[model samples]
Target: EPEVTQTPSHQVTQMGQEVILRCVPISNHLYFYWYRQILGQKVEFLVSFYNNEISEKSEIFDDQFSVERPDGSNFTLKIRSTKLEDSAMYFCASRGTARGNTIYFGEGSWLTVV
Candidate 1:
């Protein structure tokens, strides 16, 4: 079975520092997304990417954030400057088709900003 994989499952960073979370989605999946869950909050959609361009994004994905697929296989989320509010479990997800299709989520990459 295909699944999404994330690297550096745990990361600790100082406030105002930069951080990058990496992921590899199922090979045949087309839609990719980034979602985050703050310690006690619901999972929130950050951004979605398809066809090499941003398809949708939440207000949380502001100027400090960016996503890129440097290689066809790897997707990366970069935060230019982190804040205490940025600490959360970030999940990388993908789906073969659309909303009705099954979406695969990677084991979250936990980011801790001090």
Candidate 2:
């Protein structure tokens, strides 16, 4: 089965730095989503995109964050300025929209801001 892929499974950065995380969602999926988890914390949804616009977004998607479809198969998330609290597992996910459908997670791009 096709799977969502993310690069640099782990990232470490200094405070106030910038970071760009990459993801390749499933080939045929229609909906793309981003979620994050601080170590030992719960999963939190950040944003969802469909048809090139943001379908939904949570409060956590602040000005420091932005997403884009850079190509037919690649999606990216950029953190303009990282902070110590930005350290966490940032997961990229995709699904076909069934409420009951299982979404695929991209292993995860763990960011550590020190």
Candidate 3:
């Protein structure tokens, strides 16, 4: 039962700084995604990648964001400049084949920008 892993379950940062969140998705998974929940807000999709390029990206993935698969098992999300509104629980998820199409998620990487 291998699962996705995200580092720094929590992070606190100033209003303007750089932050890099890391994740290791399941070994055989095909799709990788980044979703965020802003405190009490609903889960929002930031981006999804497959075959080493972006499949889809939501409006929230603005100029300040970037993602990478630096190795066989590592996925990373980088934010060059943070803002107060950037505080959220960032979840790394992988979609796999079940009986049908379904997506699963990691616990999350929490970011607090103040």
Candidate 4:
């Protein structure tokens, strides 16, 4: 199975700063997603994108957060004005078009806010 890849395996930034986490989904996948785990908490869904547009998003994804497919292969999540509450392991995921296709997650980008 193809896998998703994320950049900046780990990052440390000050509160109120902006951060952009990048990911490259499987080349053949049509659906993409961004999820995060806050320390020991369960994973939380942030947003999902398809056809170059956002298909769904969670309440956790507020104005401070944004997702974009900058190109055919690059999907990115930008967090404006980061906060300590935002510290978490951000995971990039992708799935095929077929129903029930497994969603594969990247190793994850660990964001630490000071």
Q: Write the per-residue lDDT of candidate 3 for residues 3-101, one digit (tens) a residue.
A: 889998999999889999999988888789999999998999999988898889999999999999989898889999999999999999987744246
Q: Write the per-residue lDDT of candidate 2 for residues 2-98, one digit (tens) a residue.
A: 7999998999999999999999999988789899999999999999988987889899999999999978898888999999999999999998756
**Each candidate: what lDDT?**
0.95, 0.92, 0.90, 0.95
Residue 9: error of model 1 in Å? 0.3
TM-score per candidate, chains pooled: 0.96, 0.94, 0.94, 0.97
13-92 per-residue lDDT for model 4 (tens digits): 99999999999999999999999999889999999998899999999999999998988999999999999999999999
In model 1, the runs with Cα more than 4 Å from the true position are none
* Poorly placed runs, candidate 2 (over 4 Å): 97-100
Give the distance in Å from residue 67's predicted Cα in candidate 2 to where it truly belongs.
0.4
Pairs with steric clashes in candidate 2: none
Better of 1 and 3 by TM-score: 1
lDDT assessment of candidate 3: 0.90
Ranking by TM-score: 4, 1, 2, 3
**Model 4 regions more than 4 Å off:** none
Q: 8-95 in candidate 1: lDDT tens per residue?
A: 7999999999999999999988899999999999999999999999999999999999999998899999999999999999999998
Model 4 residue 8 CA deviation in Å: 0.7
